[model samples]
Target chain A: MRVPEPPREMYEELEHTADWALRVQGRDLPALFVNAALGMMELAGVRTGDEPGEVRRIELQALDKESLLVDWLHELLVALELEQLAFREIELQITGGKKLVGTFQAVPIISMDKPVKAVTYNELLIQESPDGLEATVVFDV
Target chain B: MTQIRKQDFTRLTPYLWEIPTSFQAGMRVPVRLYADERLLKAALGDKSLQQAINASMLPGLVSHVIVMPDVHQGYGFPIGGVAATRLPSGVVSPGAIGYDINCGVRLLSSEVGLEEAKPFLSDLATALYRNCPSGVGVGGNLRLSAKDLDRVCREGSQWALKNGFANEDDIARTEESGRIPGADPSAVSPRAKQRGRPQLGTLGAGNHFVEVDVVDEIFDEQAAAAMGLTVGQLAVQIHCGSRGFGHQICSDYVREFQPAVKRYKIQLPDRELVCAPLDSPEGKRYMAAMACAANYAFANRQIMAHHVRRSFEETLGGRVADWDLTQVYDIAHNMGKIEEHRVEGELVKVCVHRKGATRAFGPGYEGLPEEYRSLGQPVLVPGSMGTASWVLLGTEGSMEQSFGSTCHGAGRVMSRKRAKKTVRGDRLKAELESRGIHIRARSMPGLAEEAPLAYKDVDAVVEVVARAGIAKKVARLRPVAVIKG
Candidate 1:
């Protein structure tokens, strides 16, 4: 599995009174999606304390890139709870037009800072920035 | 949207203000607020007023959109907002109800006095933290199959009753008797059920907690006695909603309604405000799915309350004469309910969407449990952790002016990130401990993020609503211990 490297300052947390919002940017759609996943896992407080590792693959398709990002992050949230998995390495690749196959080097979580309840469509907009693409994702925590 | 200045509002009263429809073109109705000048300034500090303006544009809105004193910035709509859409052809926006469907607060009163339990307060906190499952990535005791989970979606607190996690009184005291009727399990998606199944009875993270409090003051003695709340007596407040179950259901519908908005030729300033006509097939399906989530939340809180009672029994039962914990009332702050409200002195059937607000139905509302019918519906407003929570009663003014809705909590003033940066969780815990409040939290950072300083003063928020006559003060509760996820 090919582990992915994210661009510097790909994502940052935005100030929200009631929930967490992430501002993410990347060179392309795939990078944008991966960076958003990493940013979300970061907000979930995914820790690295020499935790046990598991390699897993996820494949999904959506109506478009925005939905794709929401779907990807949502899948991570469910896995974090149901499977007790946190990402250690992130890998994603576009396939067959709308579909994307991704790999996650996950860990048995020692602990996370907080729980991200749901990734919301509230003000979710994937835009064409000068760099490439950027978006803001809000969460129900 | 134009910037809303306090000057733009015409003061209707000491605690009421309004921005007339002429303030904004295309506004179907005016936007009203229950706030004093100070609280109005706090609301104008954020984008809440602009969001309220957006809500006023919604078609079929009855009268105006009511903003509570605790109003703050939220996604598509302001948090502390209540809007009623006329029946038949009016719209229902899931964004207006929030992601955690039926997210609410429940108050459980006990005969045990805080003075008697003071010695065991530490043990009680530990016991509660251990017994009631909470925090990130935590799972509950019960694990259900796909079929049983569907039943949970359908049955709500009744499912808990059948599983020995709840009592008849527990169901009866809850909103909608712990189930939103017409919950069609088929309306819920498989993925939503899967996320919901394991989280049942578990207090999922972020702004959710089980707090042990003392009824510090009673305003309406008769109402307090009816609700079994006495000054100095201990009460447990469970603040959470339908965990992953509700979130998934809302997420599924919000995504589905994106297309529905386009098909209906709706013009929304924000994509998140996607909605459907009340009579459309999508709307019926969403209502059914939302009902399932609402029911699940009722059951979720009921089971947690049950476990909390067990914990109280284990830690304080032998020492106290009575170990029984009775349900005062269980109310949902985030919900969409079909109710009758008078608009312009004419009664109309409407669907009221309360995002981060409580249903403060006046006395004589048929839906309230028989005991509370005379006292009005009990509104439990949990302040931020380490602050004062409230028990208030609905009023005729609420039914007449605000569609029987009041503020939910001490609305957040600072962002979670800012709270973490400004205050250390451990230091905040120490501060609360110095104030004699025992705390058992999963993460210090998590605890810091919910600092009491992050929210508006609960007393002030309560005063505004009380003075406005939307809600009458019943009792004030001061926390003695807190357990957080």
Candidate 2:
């Protein structure tokens, strides 16, 4: 299932040597972060259970755009593993491309196809293209 | 960044190949590869060689970078690669060490004959699957609070010993006595500790397993005897790492070291290869935190071994005359160690970073335990599922060439997606069962990704290293049962 993203935002899987990679694009940083979260959830194969859990808020601020992206996904992984929550409804706002505050409607995880160990900074770059912000995220397995 | 071909390499021997320093700019050393004909082509099939060249650019590198037969593409540095940097001046890159800190393997030998235990194989696999907590989001058997978790960092396998899960011999036979020195929990991030605390003894998902193997062949009688390997006897292998604890540690350091590269003025071809001077504060802290994860891994395996022992007793204790399992050796494949090696005929200390490579310190090295000192360290090379695992002995040649390191396992040749597309997991399980292998997996798709055909032949990988004299073969193991998360 495709993760819901802002209009005009897109993400696709990229072939990597040993790990999973995704090429994501958005009209802005907020759109990009939203799609990237969806891409990560897709890569991890998150399955939601029948019972809905609760609404959780994840507020994080990174030094830069790349850090912010990593922090966002890493937080989601922790929530899924530690709290057993899988968020399907996500609202994201990137404040001046630095601060990020997100609210997610989460449910219990029924299953995961595989573990994405952690998101890595290996050749991670958030670049501005003609279309908008584009980046490639690599996940260690 | 260009694709490397076999003709690009200079053949130093039938099994040894080298790429001169002129091939890349800012290289402090050349790249030397150990692989045979077919294996050489396999190494060229991906970015493994270019990654090795990228590794050669690290500052203060002593000798040429070493590439093993099982080389494959990996983030930053290639798997089955080794590089040693000069002490105090060299750089430490967490990327080269990998996300799974001290991801290693431990072998346990049992006296239970395979013939006597054949009927109970299915039960044994089930018992192992039930007892050892595995799969995604599965917590460990024991949950440690913040304080107890700190002790897990500083003490390592000793914590398992104190908890009555490990024995004296198990500790003595482990690498670094199952605890790396200089582990400072204060250096580890609070987030890393929180992720690690509840997951201390878990065998997390993806490529991790507990396999029951039967000794199928013995190549070297003396070495096999020392390891207590008797053909037709049951043996257990635990392959895993530090779990999220190590992942968080590596992630934090890799992110933190991003700016350290500019401060040290060390030019890197890849951003993932960010590093700092060995004596720098950033580097020291990374090493300290890495040590804690390494210790946690040692303990993780210790506890898992304890569970393996329990499973053996529960399944075979009554039927078999003796169902006890003894420790052969436990060694970390992904690790960075400070050791003295001869560079240009002069002995000096260097930090050896082995990524997807096993430490094969030769006989007479002071680091080896007493019984193994004369016979050389046992280099455990587990094969792909249902294939033959190997036991090899380190040689003096390894010390001279590969910095006392060798291949880790049957490196991946096909991507997980491709593997999943090509084979059905349920069908694969049935096929393995037909061949006398019992399988218990939390997820069937995870099994398909690790299908035997998706990896390079383990026998061929071992042959290249043995022919190159980095290590010698001792015995071979065939899988009879496997438990995967």
User: Which candidate comes out best when scored by DockQ?
Assistant: 1
In model 2, how large is the Cα lDDT of residue B226? 88
How far off is residue B315 in model 2, in Å? 0.5
Candidate 2 — which residues are off by over 4 angstroms? A1-9, A50-53, A128-131
- Residue B148, model 2: lDDT of 90
lDDT of 1 by residue, B196-271 (tens): 8888899977889999999999999999999999999999999999988888898898888877888999888776
Cα lDDT, model 1, residue B379 = 94
- What is each model's TM-score for chain A? 0.88, 0.87
* Candidate 1 all-Cα RMSD: 1.9
Docking level of model 2: medium
Candidate 2 per-residue lDDT over residues B111-150, each given as its tens digit: 9899999999999999999989999988987969898988
| Candidate 1 residue runs with Cα over 4 Å from true position | A1-4, A49-55, A94-101
Report i-RMS for every model: 1.2, 1.5
Residue B426, candidate 2: how far off, in angstroms? Answer: 1.0
What is the TM-score of candidate 2? 0.97
